[model samples]
Target: MTTEKETLNYGPVLFHYDLFPEKIERHGKVKKVITKRGTFALKEAEMSEDERNWFTHVIQRLSEIGFHQVVPLYPTKFGDYTVQLGPKTYYLMPWFASDERNERAKDEVLLDHLGKVHALTLKEQDFSNEVVEHSYQYLMNRWENRQFEMERFTEEAEQKTYMSPFELTYLSHFHQIMRMTEEAKRRLRDWYDTCQREKRYRSVLCHGKVSRNHLIFNPSGEGHLLNFEKAVLDTPVRDLAVYFRRAAHQRDWSIEEGKALLDLYEKHVPLLNEERGLLISYLSYPEPVFNAVDLYCSKRTQYSQIELVHRLESRIRAMKKIRDFCDAIMIAPPPSMDENAPKNIHIHDEEDHI
Candidate 1:
């Protein structure tokens, strides 16, 4: 396998042959390596000095909790939670191999695994107050700041418009989603704040990005949640929404499937009804949030520009698909037969809407 490290030239920290001859796969933020000492993955995340210190504490807390499905690897050679290489810091973990992919597995199965992982680690983990505060503030800051920047991208100016007709159309739709995302962020902030006011959100270590890519399903009927770079002290259900988003990618899973996964997770950790709303909010925008950020930074005018634009367009197309899928689910709430409750929960696609 061709390792991306060899090709990516990010200044002086170039990983050389001396780093060892190993092949690894890039999954989300982590790069997995197969070696003589068994497979391991390196998680690279950018953080401020203070956040790095907090991250170290969070990692230590995770180690104390004896997290199952997710394992934290100590850097015995470096004597630190992570090695700072220029603009980035990297953590490591044991890479696990799994059997054939469970392509047909329902979304509930994914939720089941996520719930187990969340239940195992978040329960009783002594997350420091700093970490908890930082995670929330960071998330809110990111959501807010990104929303502001995305506004410019959505500006309907002739000069700012795309050159081609197809590009212009895609840009228009992309801007609309960006608008919806901003609104979603506002709602998320409101809900998150309410959780804080009610003391419903306990300070616990949460897998920030819980998706199919970060998971490895083993032949022994086990799914491992890898990549803890985003792991921090936050509401545990945040992980659930992220995982659900990935499951929602393929098809509109029946409300039964969603409930089944909820039950599976509840088995490991009990979730209050309010928590479910937060999870749904997190899932509202889905992948577009990430895609928007990536495209914002990826834009350029040169040799590699066309390729990046193509990728951005592709992601926008994906965003549309996800938006429609989520719309169908919202139009038909779970247990649609229940007459006492409202027939459908209106979900709008607008920037900063989450």
Candidate 2:
């Protein structure tokens, strides 16, 4: 550990206050500065003035809404959220102690805050039907291309004189990949139809990178979200999809465990019907297949054939778990407008989407 006697200085920004650097810790691009005032994390990234302003606004908004889960950025004495020293730009934020690993209570708090963030940030807008249709068509076309690639690979493998171990393993699971793709397409079509009929969709400022690493829990077991650089204006399910996928993967794709996590989130903010359908669509996609295929075909072959086979096998197991989860939590289709008055669609526990 290195300590600085004088305050840290960068370009026009200088810590003139009683800020003695007690210790310094570096993780990737982020530098944690432990000082007498408080522990602060620093990151050097290329950020424009507008981007800096946007980040400041987001943090301020979250703080104003009483959502303190986000690690707040401390402006310099000059009241600037970011400082530039020559060509390099730096941002500062208070650091909270994070548990080395995720605990159940920590995750619960994380989802609770996330749901509140989504609920508060949600804005209703009448999405253009054409735009929605086009997006769905594009997704379906991409899925079709992936299926075609899988078929091409299978045929190539069949024609080979001696199939490699990876090829044999992949070939064995080809049907499963195809089935997953088909299911994804079907769910996507349903989502598109629902969106088209609804005409409107809800969008929220999502914490795009919802990973365990980004979740920081204090000593008291309160969780705070860090790294909003990838945050975007998207459907609230975007965050849920990321969180649930990682959670499910960590828990061996346990359907009950995933549902329990979802239950925690819904306790704070219940998901709408279209939102649930979209979540299914997002989870149904054969991301593992696409990822494995991309890696296998890429010029960089870092892993051995055996390693690739193991990776694929792991993915197959994960995919199976996700499929089981989807089946268990499948929301019943909406009633036809002509059949009868629309009945409320409720998830398990009989809780209605607010």
lDDT of 2 by residue, 194-270 (tens): 88888877777788888777777766667788777767778888898888766766634478777766776665556
Clashing pairs in 2: none
* Reference-based lDDT, residue 222, model 1: 67
Per residue, candidate 1 scores C-alpha lDDT tens digits across 85-113 of: 77887666666665556645634555665
What TM-score does each of the candidates earn?
Answer: 0.58, 0.82
Which ten contiguous residues of candidate 1 have the minimum total lDDT?
345-354
Write down the lDDT of every candidate, Cα atoms only. 0.55, 0.71
Backbone clash total, candidate 1: 19
Which candidate leads in lDDT?
2
Residue 41 of model 2 has an lDDT of: 77
Off by over 4 Å in 1: 1-66, 72-95, 101-110, 121-148, 158-163, 171-179, 182-186, 189-193, 196-199, 217-221, 246-263, 285-354
